[model samples]
Target: MNQTAPATLRSRLWWPSAAALTIAAAALGATLLLPRLFSDPVGVDPYVLRLTGVAIALAFVALVWSRFATVRPILLAVAAMTAAFSVFAGGPQWIENISGSRFDFNTQVLFASAAEALLTAVVAVLAVRTSPSTLRPLLRLRRFGPTALIATIVGVAVFVAVVMLLPATLLGREGIAPVALARDLPLQGPASVLQSFAQELQFRGLILGALDRVAPPWAANLGQAAFFGLAHIAVVYQGPGAAFVPVTIVLGFVLGWVTQRTGSLWPAIVIHAVADIAVTVGVIPGLYGY
Candidate 1:
């Protein structure tokens, strides 16, 4: 069967993309109305609002892009980037966030891996079986094969270096804590490594791919990066009037752009994941108290 769209399932497959789009819009709407939903709010965090808002906007845009005929490549790309970000940049924080009373990187890695597998499966099914027009995206790859691979490596390297060199102050109070891996998380070493790799594939590779085709590099970068940061909503908390939202959005935009310009997610994924790992490992023992 042609991978673009299987003839038999074309009619029924429209719902997936449509559903995805709807979910995106609903998410956006909720963010706008969050104030009304919560009464006597303990403490409103602007970052929470920021994340919810961008998720909705991006989902809406993705839906609109689905209506086109020539955007399949871009859609694939977006999916890839989103998936990657969820794992690398977003996963470690997610681990920290949901740990609540019981925290372990091994557990977090397992949960994250499972989620990624599910997402990849969903996208794969849609890509192969859905109406190409229904699920298409707005970006396309100008080049592929070896060049893409090279770009991915170089991009990931540069991003990692930049993040490493970034002053600790840039992360802000409600921002991501600095962490990198020294000993690797317990028995899950192989699994953790794979999770990091998968993250780059989804976010930098997939999501950026779609956005790049539709908007200018800046726009695409900003759009996807916002989603990228928002995806970390589970991790950070901010006060009602705090500027967390704007900061996260700005950070997301920068990371997303870096991935797009390099034509690969590797750059964003490596730095993003490594940064988290470093933070997780805590300050080096030799430097200070750690």
Candidate 2:
């Protein structure tokens, strides 16, 4: 009877799990491949683009159809769409093209804010349509006590230290300008908060929770961290070297860990926001400015 029950459960879960993985792979592939095929020298035909769009629309409908039945497929769709938009819409090349007067801060914030808003809306809709009960734990703040707050503070401090130390240790210099940082703090601080909130919502709340349905908790945590890290490739075009990738991946791991441990996304959001604010304020007197 025990063996039969186990086998029965696997049979019930197998198809949904397979469907989730298939949709995720398809969405990711379309996001990456479609843009290349449509851009520059390899420009795809308009008819091809239209057909691709139709296909994606149909896929989206299928995802929605399954959302109330299972969370993983919709979760995969949302995560892939978020990453794709972040890369193709406001990526470094797009930023460079649109940047005119306030190239550094304002342009980046505007684009990032728009992308984050869109992703947040999508996640919100999915949460409402799918299973609010599944997401309640991620949204609840009962676990966000003194312990979590202290951990967030410590995490932000470590992040600041790393940002300060990396440039000197790896590149032989430090970037710091107190006066300029102070002057820009008014703008950068709120922008940092918005950016952090958006990321935490998508990654910790949506992606992590979704992955949990399909895999073991630890595997889900690591998988989301990897996705978060890869999404930062756009940063390479903005500046910094390949090292940024690993650093962000590690950061993602830490943030994901805290989110899972706390049973809430608030701690991770606070840590991320504070870390960005510290980076903007030149907290450690470093050469690698935010």
Candidate 3:
């Protein structure tokens, strides 16, 4: 009876899990592949150069589709995730519009990152309010112990070490300015931290949390990581940084594993923040993030 029951459960779940994974892959393709194929790709709005329309459509499907009811929360979470992400990507435009002038680069990062985190928070809370109780355990914000602490220390050290050890040529840096970083770190540091937190909460906390409940652990981790990695393809769309996408995929998988192992979100957030800070400080893009 036990063996038969397990088989039956897998039979019921296989299709919905596969469908959710397909949605993630489509989201990635839309962001990474379609843009380069078309010169002037349309967007949900002036801000979201991509993804929101498809996200909303998927959300509608999740609302109506009774077939994939087993993984409905995961679908909704992904859909809401892309919608919120669009809001984040468009944050700079709205901020500039509201302020009537481009603020200092660090200041811009500060505000935009904060706004993104805020909007994602609202989306996350709402998802929780509506989702099944099973979803609650996956968004582990409370766990912090010896294991999490040690993981964070090791993770951060690795990030700093790799960036510092890499040659300037490989890092794509022209020069380093200690004075400029000293001036900017005060603001940029927090900005990067907030930005990382926003991303971790969205990809790891909200989306991964939703998936972890309904899917196998490894499958859940990969789904979220693939989406996270593909989202960064915009960075390489115009540049020769296409190789960077695979690196991000590996990093995403590692962070997902860390989150699962430690049962805490802090380790992932801090590690991600270290990477963000490295990018900001690595090249010293003078005055603003140019």
Candidate 4:
């Protein structure tokens, strides 16, 4: 019995260690290989590249460890690695610079975002299926009582108001023609709504729920929020600035909290879709009026 216990313990330790090392090596390889394969050498920042490599390696280690320990570390690592990747690679802004056309840029953003959302959904579904614990369904209309409905309405109103007022307040920008905006709404509204659903499914539904397995609710909320914020840096701002990161982080936090409180992603998804659609239709104008 003594020998059996030691052997089993050693086996337990060995598997996780091996998985960690393998993941780390793969991360390193991806970090080094991705830029060479997809990016122009002259524009790539060596410092950012090396930092990204390190961050990805650490994230891999954390992810592996999450199976045996608290998932907070993995969530933190994910946020860091996501931020690094957003700034260094996998951002549409860089592709825009290379392509040099608005049509190409928008197309790239659409396709890339869609592809990512799909992949994330697949992975998340698989993870949930394989996990020992049962997960709350992504949508639970029975739980969406009058209280949840009221909360959703309030959240959506607040988000829309903030988006509409931001240009005049913080950005000091003027409004565009309501007519022009109205004309584009038919197309923009549907696209934005779809994108928002995909985002909520991937970020709040999958990533946050996964972290919840081994972390405090608050930690899982904040970790996913940070990553969501980081993911927006490239999409939202023309250049690196202080405001964009904090804004998205705060927004993400609110969405994540709402998702947790309601025990469903529906409320958050509705708010996200409404906010994004508002922005797209010029209820929020560009910074400095473009």
> lDDT of each structure?
0.47, 0.57, 0.70, 0.56
- Candidate 1 residue spans exceeding 4 A from truth: 1-36, 40-105, 124-206, 234-251, 283-290
**Tens-place lDDT digits, model 1, residues 1-290:** 22124433433444343344345534544554565466725223533335434643453454466463334433443444344334543565677876764856666666666566456545644543442443343222233445456655665576567656766544332232334233455424445445555544444444444444334456556555665555444333233313445655665565566555554445555555554454344323212333
Candidate 3, residue 280: Cα displacement in angstroms equals: 1.9
Evaluate model 2: give its TM-score: 0.66
* Poorest stretch of ten by lDDT in candidate 3: 1-10
Query: What TM-score would every model get versus the actual structure?
Result: 0.49, 0.66, 0.83, 0.60
Q: All candidates: CA RMSD in angstroms?
A: 9.1, 6.6, 4.1, 8.9
Candidate 4 lDDT over 1-290, as tens digits, reads 11112334434443343343345335544554567666655324643456455655564544466453423233333433344334423646666777667655445555445554555455445444433343222323235666667779999888767666564545433456777666566655665665776677657765666555434568668767865775564335334234667877888999889877777677887998887775555434644353
Number of the candidate with higher lDDT, 2 or 4: 2
The alpha-carbon deviation from the true structure for residue 98 of candidate 4, after best TM-score superposition, in angstroms, is 19
- Model 2 CA lDDT for position 33: 49
User: 1-290, model 2: which lDDT tens digit per residue?
Assistant: 11112345434544564455456545544554466665643323422333235435644564567453454334434553454344434444457767655466554664665566566656545554555343221433346777687778787777667667664545423455556667677666777786777777767766665555445567667776876776565322123445557867877888888887766678888888886676445532343444
State residue 184's C-alpha deviation in candidate 3, in Å: 2.8
On TM-score, the candidate that comes out on top is 3
Worst 10 residues of 4 by lDDT: 1-10
Off by over 4 Å in 2: 1-26, 33-59, 71-122, 132-137, 140-143, 167-176, 234-239, 278-290
